[model samples]
Target: MSVVRAGGDGRTEADGTGRAGLRTLLRAADGVRIDVAYRPGPGGREGRGGPDVIVVAHGFTGDLDRPHIRRIAAGFARRAAVVTFTFRGHGRSGGRSTVGDREVLDLAAAVAWARSLGHRRVATVGFSMGGSVVLRHAALHGGGDPDTDAGRTARTRTDAVVSVSGPARWFYRGTAPMRRVHWLVTRPAGRVVGRYGLRTRIHDKDWDPVPLSPVQAVPLIAPTPLLIVHGDRDPYFPLDHPRMLATAGAGAADLWLEQGMGHAEHATTDALVARIGEWLEKRG
Candidate 1:
């Protein structure tokens, strides 16, 4: 488990399970230090050797060491190199979480690192908040070749994007789960609970101009491969959320309505993950 530092970029270590794991720290666009991991596919499928790399983004309160997160990454590792990281305000990353807004920057940093490692292709898989981040990341960083930040952000662009159990809009409090989640995000007591009980540091300020919703982001992801995976039994965001996202994509995205599945990382199965890997292998 000992990792050798390669340079200021990060360090490399062997997981000893036939998967190559490199753990490192990356700075987000705003300079937040993000903890990132690159897990080489078990078959050594890298560079031009495989379809592409997969960058994994976990749900709120989830981190790199979470068993569920690890499982998802492991599942993808069977198909391609995987990148996993802690969002700002979560786990070992510095700065507080702005929920899903600034998270796009964190995701961008991870994708850039994966590309820097020689992986020409990279896909993003995210759950819940992470899911929203992926959609917005693709929209903001995927299109355009401008010379501005939008262009530089292309370093974070992804070939394919998968969003599991993500919400379509912001400020949604329709369901009981979402109501409680709002409580956690908006209440001081809830922030205490998130910091102590969940190990997630939430920011107190709200979005200044408010970022684009997933539905809005999906349309911009056009021509770029997008997959929206939602559970039929999800409590946080109902079927309508995924439907809205799919519709917004205007036939450019694929929607998977998983039967009997619940929500987010905990409810995701290895079979579903493997299926996603198969999609990435072909579509990425």
Candidate 2:
């Protein structure tokens, strides 16, 4: 589809399907260009009376074009406008991935762009690594202290937030999937595989001060309407992760321990995504 760029902020509709997609490039806190796709809900743009916007953040090794990612976007589009983007190292975005640390800036930029698009109510839905990023983004931007560069860029103002199959702590390698993930993020050969085989540009260094974990960030998201969905059969993280997040939120968070589900986008059904859309709609 051919997209017309009217200005740095103006979007060009590219999707001919009823769900019109406006493609744009947003700049992250570190000035990395992030590729963004905004799909108008059934109602269309806000000016034309469209529904609120829901930003969908993909997991590790996934991008805007990933089948699962697109499916999530499509599922949300049925209820509200959907914004999907490529994190710094994934798809057509610039810069390498710092895993979940600097990636918060990526989510921040996307949320800020969605707000700039005139959507008064903006909600974020993240999967796996993206799930962790959403939790941190809401905390950092929920009118709290701007401690880091990503925090400074996060003007959260998000109406609601969803975290799917995210880890509670950092440097966790208890599970086989997480162990393999650590190997991919820590070794040179693993980086090569990530860069070539997975098209995910991973960094060699480790977190200096170590960013806030998901459980730590959940409390700050209080009164912001948080939904934490994890699978009982998830191989990456056990039910404890979501339970801890829910506990941290006190009465502010909603936990959905999906039975028989796996992890992230692959395991999340389209019906579940649609249900999430409905939940966001009610929150708005």
Candidate 3:
């Protein structure tokens, strides 16, 4: 049974039966509505003490409804409560995609909501562009840093962060796939394709001051555990991306360079997702 209830702070709640989980609409700090879903851990329930929660952020053009996203959430639900959301411009969410920028607010709200549901520990697991957002979100809101804008409203710290197939820097066109992505993000014809073919609404402008890059942000996430996972054959970014992130993280991050992996959700196997869940459980 799915029922929607709108909250004052731009949150809309819903209750679904069994393992299907609860669904909601949360407002980003910037006013965009983010569509979210929450699945309880094994034997877990809301308003009761339960397993730690994992906020799963999807990649570019992917949403909560995507099969891989659902599969990943299901895998995590075995060990932890799972919260999955559609970033702005994707799926049922409102507003345009800023790619990785401004999506931090969406994540912050989701994290906040997860904590509000009475989960004591909240970890983040992000894929691709979402991976970069997880890194920056941890830096801005998880490390107890006072300088970041996200810190003002974030009531709970992100206990752990896992970045899968994320880029270390922004504006990268080093690879053919990346070059094509840049074209899709910048050109009018490409925007049309993104709108119809990909179902992603691309933002028109370029970065101004430029948001903090993943490598740059990873340093500030120290004291908070972090895991950086990348595929050896990732078409969007090479091994250098994870290496740069691991280097910036110094001793605080764990790097996993999968030998046979290719990229993002499509390439991630069920066994790999279960392993990631176990990793979160050990740290939780």
Candidate 4:
């Protein structure tokens, strides 16, 4: 792993290589850091413009080196600058996971890194928890109502967003199994683990999924296109989540329910690759 000091003086590490001229860059912020593996197009020169830049964010407990992440990044590398990174407290990155709260900052840092590398257009493709991070970042940074607490200055402007098997609600009200899982994992275990200063396990912390819900952030995305992909067989968020997001976003969003697919499993399918490529082609 390669370590470096982020703009905020935090320690961070990188653990992957780029295709062709592309490279991996690491950044740290206030003791929290993230790893961004950037893959430039084959014929593209460093610091030169390319087709588009796509930031691939992994799910909770995931990292830049995950097989699914690498696959998605490889798929996009042919047409755009693809970047995959580890959220804080995961893999070579530092600090604890604040659910999707602080991870937004990490995403912002990744976006800045991509911009610095000469990417003109940017898009964020996230899976599960990572999907929430991208949505929340887009909502906070996108031009929205300035009066709301969720509203903040736009840090990174994205041309589009793609979410795979992401939840629209943190509490999982309608899904009994998911709610049980949340209560079982986050409530007691999260508190216990957090007390020891260890990373927050899946069910340890009381993370308000509402704040990260794309249903709430849809309006904020406004004209920015959104592509919501989920497995019909997903036991986590269920199909209603994406359906609601699509309905809420009106025509600004499109929902793709992969029949027989499960959470994170769709990442490996050719359909996903085609869908993502089509979306980028239309929006890039």
Candidate of highest TM-score? 1
The 0-to-1 C-alpha lDDT of every candidate, in the order given, reads 0.88, 0.84, 0.85, 0.69
Q: Residue-wise lDDT of candidate 3 within 1-284, one digit each (tens)?
A: 45445454343433343444567788888889998888877663444332388899999999998999988987887777889999999878999999999999899989888977877678899999999999999898864422333545445468889999999999899999999999999999999999999989988988777999999999999888899999999999999999999999888899999998999999898999987876766664
Q: Which ranges of candidate 1 are over 4 A from the true structure?
A: 2-9, 44-50, 144-151
The candidate maximizing lDDT is: 1
Off by over 4 Å in 2: 1-11, 16-19, 44-51, 144-155
Residue 177 of model 4 has an lDDT of 56
Tens digit of per-residue lDDT, candidate 2, span 25-81: 889878999999888877644443223888988999999989889888888877777
* Cα lDDT tens digits for candidate 4, 1-284: 46665444334444355223334545644546566666665454455432377888888767777777777777777667677788877766777667677788888788767766776678888889888888887887764332333522433556678888888866565777566545545676545554344343333455654455667877788677788888888877878888887888878788888888888634448657656876767764
Model 1 lDDT tens row, 1-284: 76777787777877768445788888998999999998887654544332568999999988998999988888888787888999999999999999999999999999888988887778899999999999999999875432234557656788889999999999999999999989999999999999999999999998899999898899888787888999999989999999999999888899999999999999999999998887777674
The superposed Cα distance between candidate 3 and the true structure at residue 62, in angstroms, equals 0.4
RMSD values, in order shown: 2.6, 3.9, 3.9, 5.7
lDDT of 4: 0.69
Per-model TM-score, in order, reads: 0.93, 0.90, 0.89, 0.78
| Alpha-carbon shift of residue 218 in model 2 (angstroms) | 0.5
The positional error of residue 2 in candidate 3, measured at the CA in angstroms, is 6.7
Q: How many residue pairs clash per model? A: 0, 0, 0, 6
Clashing pairs in 3: none
